[model samples]
Target chain A: MMLHNALDRYHDRPSSIHDLDPRVKVVVTLLGIFSVLLLPDGAWGAYFLVWCAVLAVALVARLGVGLVLRRSLVALPFALVAITLVFTLPGRTLFTLQLGAWEISASDAGLVRFSSVLVRSWLSVQMAILLVATTRIPDLLHALRHLHVPALLVTILAFMVRYLAVLLDEVTRLLRARQARSAASAQGKAGGSLLWRARVAGNMTGQLFLRSLERSDRIYNAMVARGFRGQYVTINPHRMRRRDWMALGLAFAALTMIQWLGRTLS
Target chain B: MNIALLTRLWEEVVVPRMHIPDGFLSMPVALIFWVITVALLLLAIRKTQQQLGERQIPLMGVMAAFIFAAQMINFPIAGGTSGHLLGGVLAAVMLGPWAGMLVMACVIIVQGLLFQDGGLLVMGANIFNMGLVTAALGSLYHGLAARQSKGVRLVVAGVLAWLSVVAGALFTALQLGFSGTSPFAIVVPAMLGVHMLIGIGEGLITMAALAFVMQVRPDLVAAEAVRTGGGRGWVIVGLVIALFVAVLSPIASADPDGLERVAIDMGFEEVAMTPPYELFPDYVIPFLGETPLSTILAGVIGALVVALVAFAVGRLLRQRAAAA
Candidate 1:
């Protein structure tokens, strides 16, 4: 299946970061990212340290350096938005580039603001990628359930994870069929106009939704027939071990100090 | 438009990406929105669970997955580019508002968790912008779409969908303004202008889908209508917000050049001189202008737009209920 393992990029490992309870890993990753954002803009010291810290985490988790870097590129377009602001910002123009009638100037203040937002998003996503890569989705859902998330929300999330890949495959197949039909039509004539394609897209969406609704109807009926009650129940008896707490506390304290020092020293 | 600027706009401002990334919002502003979103989400969860019962739980998952998958399918816009469905209104049309909100919440949670499509710190803000706000507008639009002539239904659905996207963009500008990261004045007109065009595309897609459902699967929407029998709640919500903004806009705009204050934070509030369309030069970015009258005028215009859209939404919901 082309869609297999497309979303589940989990790297199973027995390393310390990988072995941490998913709850601990989630909490630590959140705290770590929050602290990273809290670091004042232009605090290069804080940003560099956090970057190194996340890299260390990735390393400990047996995640390849290249994978984390590549995954972190998802936020680069957003960073480009910030970078675009650097030229328009009101400040001393550090440099200017003229092309045609346009004068594009990069301001020093704008550069500072842009880079701050850029690094912040970049580093935050890196930590997030590391968290997901090390922890299994099952463990993550179990952790959410253990963390006192409502049963219904947790149940829904469980179903979401289970069927997300399946739905992706279904959609991919649908897309291929659409492409085949479109290409066949194109060979005989020009492809449809924008409106025509939009209607087709809409039809495809309607069809997919109908299929999903029918599928869910069947799934629900089957569950009810199998004597399923109104409650969605899952049993997992995984306690937070001492090592989990220790790891979280130490990481928490270190991140806190890094943020504090970044604010003061900068 | 300069080729460079056009591409930059496409890459940065014109992103089909629904959720805002981290660092665009400051700590306090994000946290405040997060708290509000969390409270709203709790109520939605409670209501959805009550309405859906336990039997409908599996369907929530399927629906969530379906929306997630659909978002990945990008349809071609003009210019060889494409935009995907935000799907909030579509979800509301299929499932009622509260359940729609839950489905949206699930999709966002999955997107953030699995793909990191949005930042974790700003996930709450993302949920608010892309999910909650859209759901509120969708349900309200659904209400307006009720019992009307087919033409009215098409026009209203398309306009409301467009307006919802624009409204989401406006709220995004407000949030960015509140964060002191970007001044409201420049961001408002700029974001609004781009989103207005984006909204038209959104409207077309939504109308097409509505037409499809109207023909083939009225039953799917029937279940949704039964859940959405809450009359005038949407009106009250719209009125309160409009009134609140109209009341507070003056005080908020008391200092005309809030950009100076924002300059201390990051310094990038250049005026967007090449706005594709200027509604009115004076009120383009209302608060930044010289007159409180202009701000209030803009606020009134805003209020009127909300009321009109809300009315359409109310009518739509009533129509759907009657049809079902």
Candidate 2:
């Protein structure tokens, strides 16, 4: 695939983590994530364990520490908003500059809850990125199908996986053309006001939609010519091996233990 | 594409796409949305399959890819921030609500799994927030086509598109509030206040798309009649009702003492509960004299000050770091 973007850019490497069956990776990652989420708010010990476990996976996968940390910043902005909750929520108004009924308190409760949310979120995002960075889109789709995601939905994802790059190229072309024309119009009398710019965007979008519709018809004709069936055909089907199950079990046990210990202690 | 366009695309790597990231929603709230989204997707698949036979399936995929690509071409909305095409209303206008929903759901799921724009668990919530809300809003206005002018339909679609984004933001805020991340009263206003400006982009884009399509291929723009399935509309109706209640519950909880007094006076409850296992038990704040109104005022003011300081400090840090 010539198309490349930072998001979902699959990096191929030979390692045990990379070699694990995609289904096993999916289950294990989900286990790790769920445990992180299920850990009672502020169980730092378990959270540390989960982080260490993720680091272990990263080492095995040979994923760069810098790469993982950089990709993980995608969740930061959303997390920042929740961090503000620590300042706003009420419990013990430890110290305050009161303006009538309004006050600012560094509540013990809010601080704990906010940190818990942020840490859990950050860990889960790491697991998510790790799973994507190691696995191919096709393998992920196959895993989803094997896991019995509705075939129709799976097919749509498959198509999306296949055509996303192509459609993006088309959009880029359209955007280039639109921006060029808009630039010319900007030099003219009508002026490129916000509304006008938006209208041009909408027209470009309409053109894209029409083009897509026409391509769909042509693609349908081509498929029908090639004896296209209504249902999706599963390609390269693979069964879980002994190693896959072992990997899954080890992951499940570690996560379960961490979660249970965390809750019990907290 | 030109060099400039390529660089623009490269720069876009820094911006967050409109997909909701994970952990903004709590488990219970996320699970509730997932259940609702799954049910709707199942219904959507059946309806589309029935409406277009097997033909709908391929079209749905194409539509998904189209929307995904189109969303990438964002222009400015405000404050040097830009917004992109949501395409829910556009999809609903182009395809019927069911098929439009199918496309939106596919797009959202792909974004989650492929890009991690939203997490796996909360992917359903993201879809429900954006797709189902769009579908419902589109369906709500589907009846306007009876004797309405193309101009009028275009205008209505434009307004609905704007409103759909607002509705999506509402559900997201509600989910966040339920998660205890923020109070509903605070989150709703904050989410809506930002989205109100963003909604203009949606409105303009939707209106432009509608008018352009109508102009170019007037024959192809078919408006599906909205009157057929009254009972089947329950999903959207239920979602709306749920959203309003979720948005309001925080305010209700804020005045617990007054509400309890009313309950006692009306004899609606046994004055003494066996255990009192309700959500916000003893929510009253005491440092400000333990008054209901005072607590609310505290929350409002605290939220305001936090937001103001956060915005100012964020700008300062960004500028200082950049300058350095």
On lDDT, the candidate that comes out on top is: 1
In order, the interface RMSDs are: 7.3, 5.9
* CAPRI quality band, candidate 1: acceptable
How well is each residue in A1-266 modelled by candidate 2, as lDDT tens digits?
A: 42244534446678888788999988887777766877877899888988888888888888877777887876777765575455565556555444454554456666878888888888888999899888877788888888887788888777666766778789888877766665444456442578877887888888888888877777677778887787667657678789988988898888888988898778
- Ten residues in sequence with the least summed lDDT for candidate 1 chain A: A1-10
* Residue B245's lDDT in candidate 1: 41
Per-candidate TM-scores read: 0.84, 0.80
Model 2, which residues run further than 4 Å from truth?
A1-11, A91-103, A181-191, B1-18, B223-324
lDDT of 1 by residue, A1-266 (tens): 11133224455467988788889988888898888878887899989889888888878877778889987877665553344456555678798776444466767776887788788888988888988888777788888877887778888887777776677667766766776776544447445777887787777777778888888888889888988776555566677899999998899888988988899988
Q: Tens digit of lDDT per residue, candidate 1, span B77-162?
A: 76665745777777766777788788988888887877777788888888887787777767755555554566776776665566
Worst window of 10 by summed lDDT in candidate 2 chain B: B272-281
**Fnat of each prediction, in sequence:** 0.55, 0.49
